[model samples]
Target: SFMVRPFSLGLRLFVAMTAGHILLKVLAGFVVNAGSAGLGVGLLVGIPSFGLMVGISALELLVAGIQAYVFALLTSLYLNDAVNLH
Candidate 1:
C-alpha cells in the first residue's frame, strides 16, 4: 500500500512530462524560426514570439519542478510509511 501512491505519482509524472516535452518541442521550433527575423521583423514577430517562449519556459520550469518535488515527497512518505520508524 505504501508503494502504491509513489508508483502512481511516478507514472503520472512520466506521462505529464512526455506531453509537455512534445508540445515544447513544437513551440520551440516556431520560436526559433520566428526569432531569427530581423529587428523590424523581430519587433513585429520576434518580441511577442520570444515573450511567449519566455512565458512558456517559466511555466514549464515551475510545473516540472513542482511535479518533481511531489514525486520525491511521495516517495519519502511511502518509505516512512513502510519503515514505520516514528
Candidate 2:
C-alpha cells in the first residue's frame, strides 16, 4: 500500500503536467496559424488566441508550482504514515 501510493501520486503529476503542456502546444499552433493568415485576420484571431495562450501559460506556471508542493507534501505524509505504522 505504501509503495503503491507514491507511485500513483507520481503518475498523477506526470499526467497532469503532460496534458497541460500538450494543450499549450496546441494553443500555440493556433496562434501561429492565425497570425500567418493576413494582417486583418491576424489582428482579429491572433490577438485573442495570443491572449488566451498567455492566460493558460500563467495558469500552467501556477499549477506546476502547486503540483511540486503537493508532491512534496504527499511524500512527507506517506513517510509519516510509514513511521507511525511500525
Best by TM-score: 2
Model 2 TM: 0.87
Per-candidate RMSD vs. true structure? 3.7, 1.4
- Candidate 2: misplaced stretches above 4 Å? none
Worst 10 residues of 2 by lDDT: 41-50
Candidate 1 yields a Cα-based lDDT of 0.76
Error of 2 at 2 (Å): 1.3
Model 2, position 84: C-alpha lDDT score: 96
lDDT of 2 by residue, 35-68 (tens): 7899998888888888988998999999999999
Clashes of 1: 0
Between which residue pairs do clashes occur in model 2? none
